[model samples]
Target: MRDLHSNRPLVWSLFAAFALVTLYMLGVRTLVPPDEGRYAEMAREMFVTGDWVTTRLNGIKYFEKPPLQTWMNALSFSLFGVGEWQARLWTGLCGIGGVFITAYAGSRVFGQRVGLYAGLVLGSCFYWVACSQIDSLDMGLSGMMTIVLCALLLGQREGASARENRNWMLLCWAAMALSVLSKGLIGLMLPGGILVSYTLLTLQWRLWTRLHLVKGLLLFLAVAAPWFILVGLRNPEQPAFFFIHEHWDRFFKTEHHREQVWYVFFVLTAVGMVPWLGMLAQSLWLGAKRAPGVDPRAFRPRLMALVWAVFIIAFFTKSNSKLPGYILPVFPALALLTAIYLDAGSRLARVISAALTALVGAALLATVPFMPGMAGRSTEVALYQGYQPWVLVAGFVSLVGGALALLYARQMKRDLFVLVLAVTGFATTQIMIAGFEPIGKARAGTAMLPAIEAQLAPGTPIYAVGVYEQSMTFYLRRTVTLVAYTDEFSFGLQQQPELAIPTVPQFVERWMADAAAGRRNLAFMREDIYTALQAQGVPLRVVARDARRMVVANDVKQK
Candidate 1:
């Protein structure tokens, strides 16, 4: 009872620390990244237009992904008003929820120490930190996947009491259905694929009989199928494009034309697991040697985690279109595994922890000179900028923490590892926030929206000459018309030669014809194109010229 009481505070402290870190990371940034902006804009558009059926970017059909994330964003916008932070709030909340759920699951599978460690590892993982702060669908899917997986694992532990496990199974189905809603088929496919493979590989057939497969399938379909079916009926073109072209063909035939060699994922995976890679390796190595049936419950959970990690890695590795975030679901599994390994107090675990701490120290030290522009700077620039001084300070703190942790471990300590991991994670989180300063300060193209908006009359007929800026379209909340010259440039000469402007004489004739009809013509052109029009003596005046775009209007007053 005394031991239990002592453990309670430590566990609560770990939870509190992780929660603070997650909140700090989430609170620091505006949605400046590519996908976040796109999603937020889409949601805002949806809310304003009240058209949830089809998604439009720049007022054109954008059927690239399903509507779940958009719907979530729209709902958020409705509740919180349309803003960058509000758009990203749900993802952040999901991320925090994932950390807690993973910890709870870990506690059930192993013990309190393992659970605390798992939560710490997960909350601090660079992948989770970065991905969770954004407005992407991947993190949502990842969170849902973690919850479903934990529920399933916990249900499996109920053992022989079908009634008790039923609720867990039902939760799994519901979570999985949410996953599918979050990111399409892979939510169901990846988890189902991994579980089946693990069961077969480990000869755990009895687990299958316990799963109540029929009821679970019905639940999944009941929850997930409606949206797909409704969306399919509404937009007949989507099913072929999404399931076949995006999923199957993109993987098998390189339809999206993103083919990388298999070893690329190994590099990506290493980078993705940063700061925890050493611990992960040690966990897998130690886990591989555990004799069968020593603790059947422990053995199964670890086995499931291993299979989860392997299956996600393997599945994405075999795909033609590989992205860094594709394997995010594997992080929770790795965290659980690492937590379990850390709890054992093995010499190997301590060595792994020490090595990882050293690497993190080096990394933090390296960031000292670069923090100012580091977040916004390209990778090459960040590296060339060297470490920032404050980053160095953070590094020194982490280094001291890590060294003390190693010393504590040598003396058979546990909490020090958690402390070091938390400190390092906090430092890394700060570094990431510092890195965003330059990007936030840098003038994103959205800055020009007000200028562009001011220039337009109630219906001045806006048109792009040789470019289509999605950011402009998103912020402006209206589609800019695409003129021949601009369309050619945006689509490129090879794919859209028809968009090329005819000769000067031909352009003048067309301009005069439009002018004769009293049409107020405005064309956004490149400076070179504007110069060419002036050279051709087609009476046009520059309305505005930025570094990248030049707005031109026909000189009706001169006429």
Candidate 2:
């Protein structure tokens, strides 16, 4: 095999591409569709309180997820201050790291040409781009797992010395621990299942002999177990409920997120791969035919990659609950396969690449005019909100990028094509951040914070009548009390019955009592609840209203 670093220019080009994608995604404003605002606010809470043990939303106990992501956000906040950009910095860095790791791993396993292709594909992937920009835990987990898998693959193939192998094993365990910190048990579950299945299927069981399994397990347990234990000890119900119901039960039951059949991931996979979908399919087919003849000792990395792709798809497909992001970890393997397939440099490969570039370019071009209107609906801002200039800029950049990609494809210049895609993606993302997002922020629940504030007197108790918006909480800088009007809907009311105020009768009694005492009460209610109150003849005056929420103040003059 050629010396991977001998092609320094190509490697640098790949790095530049990765950097471009990272910057674009990171530069964009925290968008809707994935609850970026909620995650960002939680991080703000973490930074504000400095308490690492328990997670809070709007200053209320929020245990929906573990603390690792919030910790990363808090660290960024401490250094960069609280805002959308700072909140997403860590996720962006992890995304860039994932791209490089994929490239490096490919180079080691399949040579430099393949590594460069792999990096390009991963960097330009739409799903990767979207996930990288958001303040979600999945991207970080996917990136860490990719690095660990690559390290282990390289170790298994090249580590002749015990010390070398041990070092790799330790790195793998560390990555696993970090994955656990990112999203809980599924982190360890997906990677561990893939490795175990690959080892058994490839008859590389003896390789486990070199893994120092006991030490690796101990290390993982030491790092990951303490947090779970402490969190569980602090909240006793968490141990059984989170591990059992949220993890196991949620996987097998549709109680959390139910959708379609098990094989629905095929659609997700295709969509996630986007422009590279055709190439990914070809790569997987090529891998299946060639994987068996490769030496188990020498070609184990490819087999491991296959296992990673297959196991994740299988595991998630079988789960009763599924989301688009759940299949993210499998992408690195698909990327590697696509890179190998593209490395042949055949006329057909170039054509496929050209097609992909054109498709993405077309998609971007089509999105421009609609972008501002789309922003208006999500943000409830006027359709002409200051996003037109940015949208035009993004459109122009996409045209340039598409043209560059076509030029490179015609010239058979793979590196240049990669660079063009990266540049375009970055430019489009920047337009979104600087252009489209301000409109979104103006319409997002965050926009209502000032109005809510104006209505409240100094230290007036604000309450979320039946719903909570994490973004609203962050902006308000205090926890809004939750008043449940129904047993079916009130949050935190089941465990703490004292907080439950079931039925309009209950709500009326509380409001009347508080008002009678000359105390002002402001309630944030969802549209449905406000309507329900109206239907019940509660005489609730709507001080403010929006698509999803309403603010009602009893005795409006009191404030």
Candidate 3:
């Protein structure tokens, strides 16, 4: 209440610094397995195949999730030329945009100081920064949800001009639609659920009349429904698999192999906050003690934000589906709440922030030796050992930075204290990502592409037996024939049965046919599968070998 507005220059300067790290530096890294590689290759395939309506992974109908992210990435590839950076541009932009959106809305709801600090909290949060540059759907979803959260905050202000209210609510509705496109109905449903809980807590049903439900619903359907309808028309099974199976089943059942203990989300939030975690907890404690808004009877934006954060954590706690990134929607609200508390210059918060910063430094330093444990295989441990030096450097820098932040906190230099931790955390995270190349090397099929390319003869059928690598098709620039292997693409293969060989015997017969014709063929398989094929007299010569997989070809005369 006492001149807590941000100094524009300071806010802009810090924000600019954060952008430089998130955009250019983070963009330079390799895409990791499963998610990053999968999504990047999807966009790549989208660009190459020019079949945007029916999403395909390795040329199979991939209807597991919606395609807004892929569409954006595909467009990015068109303009920038496909590379790791171009592939990740959407998520980076979203993270950068999320900061500005939170700042703008936080200032409107609380004060400029809260706005600036909230941006810092989110910008420095590991989850926000890490996911932002990774080319994941969650970053896009979190970005859109941040907008919706901001719009809800501004639109729900105790007193606002009718036009302002209408515009804000419309933006909120439109964001929900965008979220649906970004991920699924949870985009709309998550926000809607939070709103219902907020209304119940605040006893503020009056805001509903002003929500323009009819117009908003029409707008949402107009923006989000067309894709659903069109995709369903084009692929009949998609409607059931997507709406019922993907959304609900993925959440309620352990179909994705992602089930974890209910407390897993709590762990994510704790680690996700990192240097800011202590400050956030202290802020939340203080914020909860009083009405978190302009008036006692008026709605508490902080409580709403707190409720927003808690609802998300509690919402998925019991659900069988879980991932570290799913809890990200709550960060913006928590950032706002933390910012408001910090703006009051809570002395204990500064002390705790200082102590926590030191603890983070110690933890990071301790993490150096454990780096090898992150590697999947014994051979990869040496590669992970090579990464240890970078981790050590980041740890040392963070230890020093944490000490400095502790000093700044003691001096009550709020800005510098926050800035120090933010920069250190950002650097440490970037270091870890940069050092992950060795691991990515083992996981990505990228290097194998070149070796496989050198051996290819024209019309030489390439088969992936007992494995489906999502990134292989993108890197190879063509889909490999799936021989008895369809993991995530099982549903897609069901719709287009010709795309797969369902059994080992079937693949053996096909390979023999190709071999007898004196036509060379390529195959990639897990080591065990390759061994089994060899035992079955399928006749394969090793072309390339990695710790987890091998590339081979039919025993044939070299050209």
Candidate 4:
């Protein structure tokens, strides 16, 4: 019940420990496909190729995303060799930085206590924490979007000096630029839409007058325009594919096959905001209403946050393409609202939230025994079994933390109660994600790295026939020839047809020619494809293989 600000040492120590564990967990698990492996490989190729402007995946020109994440990842690789942690350094920093910025903005807009609570809420949310350690664009984009949100809140709050206003607004502009580079037009589109929604709902038309639109537009264009210009100039086909196909077509068409029912993100948000689920509905409802005696024309930070969250969720919900990560930008807004609500909420509300946490923990414990059943492949049974103990530990941690939270809430120690729940949420998510290493290992095929390395020769042909493990190309420090395999790479292959063989017959002809010339060749294919090739008397000697993939080499003698 003491002033939390007075306990500075405890607060700093808790944050320090959380940060250390998060950094340690960066390298704790293998990079899983298709996002983790795909992004990492793209960065690796950029770093190795020294072609920063043009992003490539497995040596094919890939224009699906802007190169901000790839540029950052490649910079990480240049500084510290290519590895799991290096590949993830940008996203990890973004995640951690998002927490600090949101907390600082909360303090300025609300209060110190509210800021502290906001940071805790965001840092522990399951979706935010899990994405932070993964090598993907979602965390990078979310982190930048967090900057745009926080900077706007700080810049637009009441009683700000002109100098303070301009600086924060500029920072918001720059972050939006980076956000555009991180994912695409959504960076600017999302913020622009949120601001419009907030103005219409709150009638804060004067907000546009103070946004420094002229200066902000200049800064945004400066940061975001060069890459689009240069990449488009160099690759003429990039502009249409990236702008129309990647953004417009992706949003309106279900060709990406990511379509889901309208309520999918509603389900994701409910599950993603664990331990705070009981507080979500109330916080959002409270966020829409202005507090007593606030100026009608003055900025409503809470309402802005509410509008920000709702607009983003609704934007993606209307899209024909829906992925869970698409809705990640809303978490910071949700965190701010939840933090404000909890700081002033009743003890009964706190008790109910804590009770829900404990109940969820118990449910997790009950499901621990059924993990093996979740595996679709026989090879995955042991991997899921290996994950059980971790689930057990996480469940117990959540259960005990929730019990302690209940005790603290009853004693009117709100700070301790929230801290316990935050730590519990963060710890449980980290443990479960780290526990996925066994399954990640199978998908990564990193165990085959050693055998594949031993067979490498300068300029030797390596083909990916019927399948391509994105991570394998990065781990092997080389690109693979694509043979009848172009899923996401279809556009890239169309841009550079010479980069791929185009069909199985072409690959087979090349393989036979290489054998006749006594040259070496290697291929990676699905087990079934390998079996079918063997039935056709293809000359392949198994070099290394696992349950799902096979690495085979030509049986011809090397000259």
> Each candidate's TM vs. the true structure?
0.83, 0.87, 0.96, 0.98
Q: Which wins on TM-score, candidate 3 or candidate 4?
A: 4
- Model 1, position 454, has a per-residue lDDT of 61
Query: Residue 469 CA error for candidate 3 (Å)?
Result: 1.6
Candidate 3 achieves a global lDDT of 0.82
lDDT of 2 by residue, 1-559 (tens): 1333467876697587667656655645534422566677778877887887877565555565677888888898899777777777878888888888898888877887788778878876767766787777778788888877887876676534678778877888878888888887887888778878977776767777877789989998898888888877787766675678668777877767566676788888887775566567677776665454655455466667878898899888888888778888888888888877776635455556556655665665676566556542564545444666665666666666766766776787766665566556545555545665655554455656666787777777777776665566656666666665432222334445554455546777778677777777788887877787777756465677665567887674544
Compose the digit string of candidate 1's lDDT tens values, residues 1-559: 2232147776677567666666566555555635766777778888888988777554555666767788888998899787666777778778889888888888877777677778878887778877888888889889899988898888887442667688888889888989888888888898889889987777777877767789999999998888778867876766776787667876788646667778776777676665667666778765556544566433277778888888899988988888777888888888888888777747656756666776677777876654555444353354324335545765776677667767766766566656576567656656755555434423235545565666566676666665555445555666565555432123223333444453445555666677677665666676777788787777676665554556666754633
Better of 2 and 4 by TM-score: 4
User: lDDT by residue for model 4 over 1-559, one digit each (tens)?
Assistant: 3566447787677778877888888998888888888999999999988999999999999999999999999999999999999989998899888988998899889998899899899999988998898988889999999999999999999998999889999999999999999999999999999999898888879899879999999999999999999998999999999999999999999998999999999899988888788899889998988888998888999999999899999999999999989888889999999999988878887888888888878988999999999997887799899999999999998888888898998998998898888998999899889888988989888889888888888888899999998888888888999999899999999889999998887898899888777788999987877788789988888889887688988864433
Count backbone overlaps in model 3: 0
Q: CA shift at 447, candidate 4, in angstroms?
A: 1.6
Residue 83 lDDT, candidate 4, scale 0-100: 94
Instruction: Please list all clashing residue pairs in model 2, or write none if there are none.
Output: 29-433, 379-443
lDDT, each prediction: 0.70, 0.71, 0.82, 0.90
How far in Å is the alpha carbon of 98 misplaced in model 3? 0.8
Candidate 2 is scored at a TM of: 0.87
Instruction: Give the 10-residue window scoring lowest on summed lDDT in candidate 2.
Output: 485-494
Ranking by lDDT: 4, 3, 2, 1
